[model samples]
Target: MSHSRRSILGAALGLPAAVAVGTVATATPAAAAAVDATAWTNLELETGITPQPGATPQVRTVTILGTTFLQARGAITCNLAADTKIGTLPAAMTPPTWYVRATSPRNNSQGINACRFEVNTAGSVTIYGATSGNPITWVQFDSVQTIWR
Candidate 1:
């Protein structure tokens, strides 16, 4: 089934819209105020994962209007050539009970070496798929964003 533009935008903004009419709806003040950013907190990497060269990993919780968001940035490297756990988030910034995926910076193999990461409700952040032949040693978060609440 196809979704109307109004419905897609409504769902993304956490608002209700008249999907049948197929018209765009103006965002409420509450929704417009969702751009506020909070201070960044230093994120400690899990054992076995270390920041690459000059990169410093960090996280922050921002309240966009009524919705809570978690943001992470910087880069890291893993000591093991396998799925690696990156770090943990604070309780207040813990995401909803789901796997939130983010893409790492592209590798030398013409971007085929990029890896996927998942952040769970337990605040554990992990990167998947690293092998001996094509080891995923470096990852840049690039201000990854996910819903926290």
Candidate 2:
């Protein structure tokens, strides 16, 4: 005799959906072994900051997943005006790996737009300018994807 899937399963297991979904935990040992070898410890932006600070700060935030994916972007301003105040990462990143960089200068100031930044494991980030470097104003942005298990 022929039987529908639901009829065969529901009659035999008393629940077609449960049986179809393999809800029978005792049916296999693999079901119980579905635990993650590397549990998802945490998740966050690579740069941490979505935007820096200034009259026209341009910044972006990125969310890094696992150990194989990243996305970063931002929008900033540059005009060789006052030291440009881009955005900053939040205080929640990897660590001991802090470094800063300067976007392309808007005008020709002989490296007047140089900058420095820091990133602690705990996610604390800070950005500073060189003694000779100042900010600008146009529209420049950056992103850094930092992730950890």
TM-score of every candidate relative to the true structure = 0.67, 0.29
Q: RMSD in angstroms, candidate 2?
A: 16.9
List pairs with backbone clashes in candidate 1: none
Q: Which 10-residue window in model 2 sums to the lowest lDDT?
A: 62-71
TM-score quality measure for candidate 1: 0.67
* Candidate 2 C-alpha lDDT tens digits along 18-58: 67577565467765454322222222323322323442232
For model 2, the superposed segments whose C-alpha errors exceed 4 Å read: 1-71, 77-108, 112-114, 136-139, 143-149
Q: CA shift at 43, candidate 1, in angstroms?
A: 1.9
